[model samples]
Target: MRAGNVKRGVVGLVAGVVFAGLTTFSGASAETGGCGLVGTVGTPEIGVDDTNAGLETLPAAEIALPEQIYFRTSTESFNRRWSFAARDGRIYVKEAAAQGGWRSLPLPGCMEGRIAGVSADDDEVMAIDRDGWFFTMDHALSAPKDWNWSTRYGTPLWTGAGNTLPAGTLDWTWSVLSPNEDHVWRDTAGNDHPVGGAKVSHVFALVDGGCRIAYVDPWLPVDHSYELATPANGRFRAVKLSTSASTTLVVNRFGDLYTRLYDFDISGADKVFFRYSYEDQRGLREAPDMLSERVDSGTAAIQLPAPDWVRQPKVPGEITDRISVHKTGIGSDARELRIEGESGGRTGYWVKQLTDAAWRFVATDQPLAGTRLENTAADHSIDESIQPSPYSYAGRSAAGWTATVANFDISNTPTTLRVDVGNGERLDLILHMVDGLRQLPQQRGIGTQARRFDGTVEVPGDILGSLATQPDSIRQFVTSTLGGRRFTDTAVDVTVREFRIDGLSVTLGRS
Candidate 1:
């Protein structure tokens, strides 16, 4: 094997050791209040194999000196497991080797040179060229063995023209900036062009003046959609901007940190989903027909209400060294904000909740040690119902009587039904009757309105039989004997469209 080939195996081993040493030294130095003496550490040089055959490998030394690293949060495929690093205007990639350590992969031809910055999410890797153009490679694609500059990276999908920022934009500690794959566009020729992963929905950068934002309107024509704005009326001269999902953290030049929640009004339709119960009343008992109230329905974005910029309590005598915000997982709304600061040459760490007003000091050498952020918001509850009147059915025959329950024009199916029986037994049913509702073709122009469930439910024959023999009224029989049941739903745990249940009712019939 050539020198480069030999270095590939050796690099993985050495890189692991070097990283371990660095981590140990950092922890020790922080605990001892910077009393440790350390020699000058030189940047490790990577040996690039001249022969471009099979999977390319790099010297282990270079792996430790990355200016920035991008990690993919997917395990569906080998390519999705790949992680990227930016160093000296080039991109290096690695993945876990089946046997154990990390193995270097060839740099994509398009990402070989002039790579200014790189970021990744679960789906794709977004890169910025020296000329301010943006390129991306889908993480779902197979790993490339040899560099094919033209074929690998493809043409710059997003031109940075008119989207330029001030000097030092490249050095900003940005959070993962991935493209919004959910947004797509169609050309005049009717060709459906997927929204470029490089055309991120929002770009927050640290400019010379302060922090600036570039918002890309996915609905508008691509050439005319870039809109730039200053956040919080440019109140603070921001030195860093880190964004994850709906939350953003801003660090000003003076080391003061602030955070805010923001979400674009992508869809105009505002609808709410909830569950409700009806009390037994006389008027509804006299009626035997299906009753419903018409409600406006449409699709809308999921956003926690945006609040004013909230300043986090400062870390006493600490100079901010680095900051990061990460979502708990893919498709999660909760976030963790971690800050690393240095005081008197000793490293210290702090953590704050995304929606909190206080920052807690973490007495650990490692960042984010033992810290786990979770979504604590309560789920959307059902709170609507209709009352039914009392009706004695002592003389009526139970053989030909039936009961029907329904919820029409709903956004989502109720997941559970809790029945409180007179015998004090609580029965819970996992409703799957509305599963077919989602499979039906949706009506056009209806705006997310769908008929979830509208049919008779299985009531115990004994309950209906008792109605004929016992002197209990229909309302008493239905509520106490038949058992009072109500639909329950948790919006966060399930996919919810925008719309209220237009019609929810239960009807009794006698043949």
Candidate 2:
């Protein structure tokens, strides 16, 4: 695109009150520089669908948005701060606060739990840690609803069954339970049954899909022979592995656990990895297999990876994919971006377009064409698709050539632009868009200046006609601000922590 005169939008946010002002022009400003375009257009009154012009070109400066999250006090768990979770349209979470007191609350819902993962509905969340245990107060615990319970911190009050763990296990402090999902996930060792009974090692949820419960072996099996005891009725099946996957799957007293899949061989290239965030010497090497294994005195605690679900390949879309939408970092089973082939049709890869915001999905026959640069009114987040076209500039309009650049012809749009950079420094850019496609020029504060080539002439009548016919089409407003001196993407790091204008970018609310 050729250099067209642009104006700054004069606007301000004072205590959230919107103030309208009349456009003021300087006699001298209208006579020089590149602001000469659209000079005569006085401040114009805009109609519905048009937002006030708020464009601004900030000076080269360092700017940062606060991602420092402020926490809300909780009535549950005694003011202990907790994190947030999202299920369906609702938020689910159990926070861990430092209030230093004990409080209680109902359990979180099943959206995030060992029983049922987040939503298969294609929704997604921010963090996933089977992280801590939570207790719920929302509904009185019955049969344990969906899996998440709220967090509760009692004084040094009851480190119940503390001796159960071999000194080094976690506080085993977090656990949550609601009606349909009730199971205590701990980082320590304990086997106190949720039903108020005793067994070996003492811990287990309705594992194996309510088919059986986990417990220690008779006489606490010396080598840690764990067992998945069958239900009284015995219609469903039970699952248990060698002491290898115990701590990875369940916590137990005496700091001990074993494999969830015993009798298995290591295959080539089939690596296994498990993660538990604990502060230690390298934070790598290995995590405590069972709570007791850390001290090396407990029964069989051979660390092993969990088993994978071995069902039929899904059709890329299903409710089983729900875990992704609710979990912060779990691979999704659903296909939000999937492309299908025609029956005996052209061969190409399938891609599913997730959301319509800064990201867009465009399809093509080539596996490469399936990806595109998506830009929209949502998430200002943009993806770096292709490197700057070094071959040639493809978005330029001729200065009165075949596809001529008429005085006011807005025929072509810019694909993107390379900002002018100086030295090794970078600059930052900010955008302030005005509402409504029309009423733009009037509200825009464009200072006029004489064109370097000519003094003046009758502006083409067709140019004014076109401006009037398609005012709204020019609705998008842009503002760019430079931070450092250079203009490199690696140099200019700007983070937009929040998109405050509610409803415009709907997904910003998620954690």
Best by TM-score: 1
* Each prediction's whole-model lDDT (CA): 0.34, 0.19
Please report, as a residue range, the 10-residue window in candidate 2 with the lowest summed lDDT.
262-271
Q: Model 1, range 244-345, lDDT digits (tens) per residue?
A: 543467665455666654422211111211111111121221111101111211211121112335566664545453566655533223466767654444
Per-residue C-alpha lDDT of model 2 across residues 313-419, encoded as one tens digit per residue: 11221111001011111111111222222112342322322221221222233322111222122322112321221212111112211111111101111112222
> Model 2: residues >4 Å from true position, as ranges?
1-135, 138-151, 154-314, 317-511
TM-score of 1: 0.40
For all predicted structures, in order, the TM-scores are 0.40, 0.15
Query: After aligning candidate 1 to the native by TM-score, how far in Å is the CA of 169 from where it should be?
Result: 3.9
